[model samples]
Target: MHPRHLTVNRSRSSSTSAGSASSCGFCPQIVQGRAPLGQAVGRWSDRHRPGAVPEEGNPREHQTPSRLRSQRARPRATAGRCEQRRAPGAAEPEPDRRALRRTAARPPAEPPRRRGRRRPAGAAQLAPATHRAGAAQIPCRGARRGHRRVRHRHHGHSSGPRAYFCQNDHVTSSKTSIPRVAIYARQSVEEDQGIRQQLDDGRKHAADHGWTVVHEFSDNDTSGSKERGPKTDWARMLSAFDEDEFDTLIVTETSRLTRSLTDVLDVTPPRRAMRVIVIRQGIDTLVADFQLKLLVLVAENEVKLKAQRAARYAADRRKVGHPTSGKTPHGYRWVPAGQRDERGTRYVVDEAEAEDVRQIFREFLAGATLGQIARDLTSTGRLTRKGARWHSSTVRRVLMNPLYAALLPPAQPTGQHSMAAIDLEACTPGAWQPIVTRDDIVAARSRLVGVKPMHAGTARRWLLAGIALCGVCRKPVKSSRPVNHPTPRKDGSVAPAQRYHGYRCHFSRNGDVIDEFVSELCIQRLSQPDAVDLLTPPDDEFDLPALHTRRDALQAERKNVFALIGSDPSRLAAAQDRLEELEEQLREVDAVIAKAAERHPLADLMGVEDVRAWWESRTLARQRAIVQLLMTVVIKPVGMGHRPRRPQDVLASLEITPLI
Candidate 1:
């Protein structure tokens, strides 16, 4: 029979023959001589086990007949007692009677035999024994009782089964619980306080608390003042908190977490249920009250006070002619003044950078725009004192600084602090060498102010603007509104409508006719093989080397004037006069060079094969530039009461002045 199908038979007959032995229906049939002593005892102990009953009743009396049979089947093995067995296939009556007589001779008050270790109450004990063919051992009340005892031992524990059988039939214990923890550490500055120190402290605290460190979150060189943006590890920690990845949070200090009280109130309130331990301050947000609030307030106030003190010191130093900030101007270097003066540091000219400063001023005064100067400086791979690329704004700052003119402007304090007022015209001689004279600066400013600003709304969209001139009036032709003709409708009503867009001459001629003629004539002239040589002038036309040498000398003298003006303020007026004279001389040289250099033609500059592509790639502004560079186009009047209606007539009326 299958072990699962085996059942203990509780019922029994009222009477049985005198030499017959009673047994449980589910019990395995034991072979007489092969049954071991331990196996026999174990089987008997399971069958005759007492049932639980009320304290007022006898459990034995309430047992059924099956219980009586179980009791009779048990062997009365006493101390120093033994049992006899009959030989196989032999007459067993005499031998069985002898064994019965021996068992019956034992006193009823005799104690049972003591074996190895005693079995636990109602626990089933199995022993190695030989079994007959087709026999299976079925567990009885002992198995059920053992399971009940195990459940009672671990009544409150929920982590799987507490008792499990090993290969040797022994029970083992398993871990009940482990707490997960998250370590968070931050440092505002890496040099001020290392992130490693914070992490090490936090990890040690977690170890003391016996928490399993599941994750480490750190924000290095990040400010705790700001509450938003790119606090990468902090954001990840918050997400992990929401997911309940850890039960506790460990930090080196509360300030390392956040300096902002608002951030604390915002982030901590929701996470109040979680355990937060700050090792340095001994502050646990889980049990925190007004103390955390007070600590955050103190930290914030410290940051504010430090900022205020720094600003005040900077303003005072600036007032006394000392360089307050670390950054010096491009043309100057910071140097420590003698210990006798209260002002600690003063600026001295850096010659290489000072030359660049002078060159910038000279270029601006010599007709180069701010953007052109910036581009030229950048093309030469030069950088500012801060190791940054040259920008128009940087160049403008150099020109506008009063220090470059040997003047000390009063300090302008920023933020909430108000600074004392001082004279705007206060000149500080020998404070630092100037890079440019006041008059050269004034002349450059005058030139900038004198230039007329173009109207944004009047931007040119035509191919020719200043290039085309009216032959009769000798003035430039301009693009006009679209030419309109009257259109007759089916209802016999005439409407004024636009027919084509064209340009207008100062006198009388269609703009389209003149524009087409000029474009075709320029293209045909440019396509010629001799066009290249006709456009280029000989190199011997002007003395380029001599002019360059003179220009360099004038630049050097200008720089020298700037250096001297700081020592003697009286020389400022004379320096200004000399600057204006130097500027006039530079302009004269430039005009001569400009005339001599006007040799290369537009066609030669733009390669032959690339001409069409280059023309197509140009914007309208570039096209207008090309037109002006090549030649001057003029429109001749057709005379009074006469109008040119065809392209051929318009071509004859147009005049071309080639520069080459």
Candidate 2:
């Protein structure tokens, strides 16, 4: 009988099945089906008897009928199924009543046993209340008395909750309902690639996954199978990710994420801090699966292997001098590799523009500056790629460039082509023709110093301007009013006349603007004579070498006097006094000699008459120039009535001019 059915029968006739031994007598229905509960109880009585069913017969004959009936009656809804067996043939009568007394002895309850599979990594935790202590196994949903849901084991060990926050609370209180996601997509080659399709598919996946895309970073014309290069943007993306701008990063495929295991492992440092999900690789940040990790690494290794093979093929081509394809510089045009076929379409250079380049270089080498060449081009109406006038700097640069002097030969080998090719010296000729000779380029560079004016000029100043000052503000005065004025007309008609301007003090202008001004002649008188004298040196008389000789003679004489003092004691005091007098005379001579040496180097040009004559013949402008060149003019404002009377007193002692 099924364990569930037997268990059910135990519950029925609970009272009658518990006491009467005959009612509990085991039969086929009661033994294999839902046996009577009392019969099951009585079988236990014989089973424990000292001389009851012997151990020699089939152990089944000693079967405890009571136990079998009890197992069948148990509720299999919670308890496990009960096994049924045929009654033993020739079975001894139920052991004497004394055996019944011995079988009845048994423990009431036992401790509970552990249930369910030990590991949860491959299985799930069954809800508690599915079993009873050491007695029954139940399959039900709701909690039963003293039962608690337990965590399942993972890898032969129990797993504990990583964090305690409520999921609903975390989501509800978040600043945005949108979950941040970033999509990274790339292609495997620089040519007509599938990156566009990948991006489209990625967007579709994001929509299905309900991901709110914060950014879509793409690397186009780049190989997804190449390991991270100088131009890779993943590092910058990771920096942004660390700022918590995205909750997940989605790549179109595993290869797009990385082409090497090294790059794949780089994802972990970022993942340890927050959730990282690589949808294509089936990786979730919360779970660690070694098998899946190894699979991703394997895929990346395959991509790297392919890249290595391609690199080797390219290297072999370079060894054989095959010109790798890439962008050509501005001076040359790109043409396909083929001669004119039956179609009669030939790839050729624009010869006219090439000739123009040659003409530019020839002109520059013939002592024509870059500016001259540019002007020549403009006169002939030549335009650059932008359709603008040729600038001198551009012309100069072209003159210096090697490619224009002579094009590189065709069929030259280049390294794996990249942006580096643009700046490389590798170029081919015949594909394009040279416009200028090498000698012409060298000559042009030697003469070039960027177009500049030939004659450098010096600054000329307004005379007397720097020294003259505002009487009130003390700021330097400037040439103020026009001097030469219109002549007053005798016939009542005023004729226009040339007027000359001169410097004046502020007191003569803002405070009181005056028309009649002092003569420049007066300023010259105060400045010129004294300035010439101040710059002149005193006359030199004694020569420096002669003075030194005379000093040596004086010192010898002093030593002789001291010797005399030693030779004759009586005349010692008198000799010493005489020695002192001679020494004072020598010191005076030295002073005169030093002064003459210092002053003699300057040539004196302060001839008073010459200065006066020069001052008198010059115009006001010339007079002011001479005055400023000679001395500083501090205009001491005098009251109209209190002006200086004496020619000498009217002159202010002029200060020296400061060195520039």
Candidate 3:
């Protein structure tokens, strides 16, 4: 087939009249009775209409406005030009419909030589669009640029075949819109990248590009690689993107926005006309060489490998009882690398904080409740390192932590009870100086017997809430009754019962009367030599139930870790190392539990000169501790057949029995 060619123009001349098919103002191709080898017509005007003409001296591929208007005349195979070979008064030659169809697309004279693979025999080689007719108007993959429109000047010649990229155009004509952008900044806990620096660079980039900064968002010490914790700014930026609040998203680096390829896919939507510019990588999602998905994949791999290395390094640190890179634990401060080798830099006791920790343990072991300790500390203006007021939960957390006892938390501890689950006896002691002794921690742990730790904050003014039991239910009695009514009188007149705090039951007695009676009996007994054994706590040994619970938790957690990170060999290996460390910790705890010992509960009061004076001087918790330890008290029910209206009635309804 002969080479197909056409001359086209973008606009029509207003002067073309009827019966003027050969008007020079119309496109030369239309005036000559043919158009390019195309079938697609541009219905809507190209967004890049008007004079965006390239400079004449520019050597780039852009076509000049004047050059686009004129087309070089090509030799035609037909017998005559539309007008020159036709009669002056003759009607225009009727277009032969069969011939127009036969030459709609002319194949190359010779098969075009292609690299690598040979073109199949008899393939239709398309003539390049706009080779001489017009400039290339390539549509952007994700850019804000507009597509071009190729229209015929004459309405009468509108039926010619139109072509819409029977093939793609290699050259692009970018028409950039004024960018309104949102800047996003992120830094991980392990990273030292300054968020301010990222923001500053983003601002500078926007200035350089003549882009407007619509908003700025940042997350410091936040991990983009991990889908955990609050990445507040990151989430807000995504929401803004979805809302179309900004046309462009600018970040200092691709990884700062996301280390996950899925997130990368979500950020850029060509249909939404959204763009992402990564400053460090010089990547624009709208550019021809955008490659963000590949970059995202590389970033994800790097983060995964980095996580694995960090986990392994932490494991090594743990093996030697050294703390890893992270926030310093309370009561401890990091020793500088200048003071020791980089690897040897370790945690040392912070005297002020350590003293506070020791005091908390000291008071807790002395029968002071967690709330009382917290209140005392608060009253003394002693707050946490973060300057937050102490709560009972905070006090309990301090008490539960094995760090004070020179022990580390598990290799992989999850949830709030991480410290509560540590087994100091089973694990290798840390190199740092301990604020509290193992014996003190063991005692504190034993005292943490109940499920509801918040109960420690309740006021214990009534001494025998746990020590005293009810005769009917055999359950512990409490002084909770409010005597709102008077006692009964046979003559229908009322006589009020002595209104003092008492155990609420039909058979009742004053709490002060009962406490006085129990105290006298306890003091009298301890005053004797035979009660010597009762002066100190019993000799006993018990395994730590928390250690067992921690072991089971670690095993379940390891299985979960495997499930989450199993695909990556580096991360999987790191998790396996953590698992081994967990096992080592468990074995150590179990061995220690097997041979552990307990401390005496009454050791503080054992040497008091006067037992009654000592008891009076103690806090309610200590007094109740002594009462629960020495004897069992029951507010027994008395029948009508028993003594009534007698002074000994208090003794009849109350039962006090010695435990030792």
Best by lDDT: 3
Model 3 clashing residue pairs (backbone): 39-162, 39-163, 40-162, 40-163, 426-588, 426-589
Pairwise TM-score winner, candidates 1 and 3: 3
Question: Where does the lowest 10-residue lDDT sum fall in candidate 1?
Answer: 1-10
RMSD (Å) of each candidate, 1 decimal: 24.0, 25.8, 13.9
**lDDT of each residue in 1-660, candidate 2, tens digit only:** 333234443433333322233232444345443556465556646665777754442234444544455455343343211112233352322324554354347344453456764643734333322111232111111111122323323232233322212212121112224457777877656643476676676678779978778877777666544455655667666666667676566765666766556655655533323334556667664355354457667887776687689778756554443333554433555455565344322223456566557656644433344565566567667777568887766675576555564434233243352221232124333223456554454345434434343421221133445456555666787655553446678988877765444455543321111111223344444455455555554456456567768777887887788787776789877787788888787766556553443311112234445544554543333344344444454555655434344444444422234321
In Å, residue 214's CA in model 1 sits off its true spot by: 8.1
| lDDT assessment of candidate 2 | 0.49
Worst 10 residues of 3 by lDDT: 39-48
Backbone clash total for model 3 is 6
- Estimate every model's Cα lDDT from 0 to 1: 0.57, 0.49, 0.62
lDDT of 3 at 134: 40
lDDT string, candidate 1, 48-88, tens digits: 45763333322233445445444444443221111112133
Give the alpha carbon lDDT tens digit for every residue of 59-137 in model 3.
3224333443332222343323334423357566465666666755666355334334443686544334333234323
- Sorting all predicted structures by TM-score, with the top scorer first, yields 3, 2, 1
Error of 2 at 82 (Å): 5.3
Candidate with better TM-score, 1 vs 2: 2
lDDT of 3 at 16: 38
